[model samples]
Target: MNLFGYEIRRKSNNTASNLPASTLSYIGVPPVFQGSTETVGTIDTRGKAGQAKAYALCSPLMSVISKKCAAIKNLRLAATTEDGEDLERPDAVRTMSHPNGVQGIADFVAHIEAMTQIFGKAYIVRMESVGLPEAFELFVVPNLCVTENAAISPALSFMPDADIVDYTVTICGSSMKIAKEDMFIVRDASYDLNACGGNISRMVSLQKPVNTFVASYEAVHELMINRGMLAIISLTSGSGDIIRDARLPETESEKNNIQQAFRKYGIRADQFKYAITSMNAAVSPVSSTITDLGLTDVQKACKKEIADIYQVPSVLLDVEGSTYANAKEAKTILYNDAIIPEANNIFSVLNRIYGFEDFKVMPYYDHLELFQESKREQAAGMTNLVNALNNAVSGGLMTTEQAKTELLKYIV
Candidate 1:
């Protein structure tokens, strides 16, 4: 079906809440200093200096949904899938750098607000990391806390009588402009696929020139809020799609800096054993990825997932009157017995799996609906696809004559 016929507004009898500013505040990198520890990564460099690398990271800002008492009973985190049930333990790690070459934080935030269509008011965080390396390096300094320019406040969408977000949104310098729209179900995204209005698409597409867009509530603490880690708690009331473009220097430079920095920093061939290794960070990877692919008894899967979160191996999950309070208490027991003690015993092992020990407890995140294509990614994909197809044929995966046929099959 063609996408152009979609209308943005659907008339209603009630009034809408005035939307807030879209570009709330800006997040800035913490200033570098002479004594801070350097975070290095995995690449061996040709020994260069002064290359600028910038990336955005994200973390989940968790809070109880529907209440602020530090607890929400039976806060459903589990879901059933073909494979099994996903025991709802939302364990948030920091956002990894995105391969799409996405840069500025503003563009990142816009992508997130549009995602309310699927995940309802959940916990999230967005962050950006900028490095000025003559050669890319990944080095971490302990006790370093960075800050951002702005933060989104506790705002949820609500129509006069409606409880959910069914409207399209455009956020500009601290203002949120909303328009009504028609939508249809999409098997992929958690919410119905939002067919864009001419205005929404254009507005979303405009973010490339900038970074990501985020919330206004981050300023509750210091002027330079914790860039070390971030959390997003959105009460969007189901805000619909706001589009985003894929092209921007922000995306490319961030990755280039990280990849190159590590190469440049590592292979120095000396003893800094605990001296410093490489550090890799960037925007999170979001594709039309339905990962944790293919399983049976998704409910069982959920059970396992919760077990992993609590670090309570199945042998330990007492099925004795398993209530949520019991679940919470059980997790606490696991945390104290296995999780905490194990954490101390396997510090290095934890760092290897969890980015860094710090990241496991706290980090940053980029909040967005996962399946839609950002303009930047959409365009970059084309050039790469051509090269990929040619390489496939050269490797004898297909005949030269069959290359075009093979390529077409993958593009759509």
Candidate 2:
């Protein structure tokens, strides 16, 4: 498949109808730097997406954040008037409840959110039938490249809606272009201009921590395979001089015997084995240990940094030092700070695309038990304040207007 004049090969064994071939192929090198030549740095969109996907698959912390944020299933589109009053759900809003025939609203939005988090952007295609205006389908494009129209002038280049012409979507080694009006894009904040303000993937900034995490695991694996070698053994004669190379082994069988002895009788094993040398040689041990490398501390620090970059609470990643109270609070923070904002951003763009003037579709979380508990607590506090104000007015401690003024402060 060709993307921005670059060719990407498809894997030969990828026969699954549901999977995109581009996803299975090696990451393509971007044609050139997207933004201005004077820009300080360049971003490779495909390469970055590939790296992010690998990290998300390898690192537990990153995987947790991506899954936790995308696991939100309580989202619903609600219609409301300009005066903040609830209105009856319109047909457009009802259609969004199950955007496509296969996936419900929750699953559809979850897929979009997951892709956006991993690839820094997601493209949703609007499949409208010829005569059925209300019967439209929505599905995410697995791999896409945005192409700008040549007709757009330099003055209006920053306006993506007008500047973008079509999206080149690659699927199963085939490619097609979708018109701009039929696509909805959700992306993180971007500073790039040449690529229609495409976002820089968050994984680009987390390379160091992810590499450290992987390296630490590799070191442990190597140590286990080597049978935990802790010291370098040296042989010396009884004269306190190193044994000469000529005196060591003269035949292949002798060399193999020495190697076998060392392998069998090295370090602390299930049963202690002794090496018997007939030359009256003395052995010295040069000590080394994995603890001296401090890999555990390094691994912990890397996990913490990865979680911080994704705005995930560290308590969720590592429950060793977490209490029940703090764990609950951390979950609440994750939902309020990361998940809800992202859901709103996607749905708000959908509302604008449908051009609903009488009502707007939005996601609400009042049904969640976490927020429900908070509401009950708030209601109790408000009731106590109202009773206190009433008692003050009845006891002549304060005038009715003064009590009302104080009550307003709390309500607001």
The lDDT of model 1 is: 0.28
lDDT of each: 0.28, 0.66
Q: Which prediction has the highest TM-score against the true structure?
A: 2
Per-model clash counts, in order, read 100, 0
lDDT of prediction 2: 0.66
lDDT of 1 by residue, 172-243 (tens): 212222221221111111221332211111112112211111111122122233322222211122332112
Model number with the top lDDT: 2
How well does each candidate superpose onto the true structure, as a TM-score?
0.15, 0.72
lDDT of 2 by residue, 277-337 (tens): 6655555544334586687888888878877777788888782489889888987998887
Model 1 worst lDDT window (10 residues): 46-55
Cα error, candidate 2, residue 83 (Å): 5.3
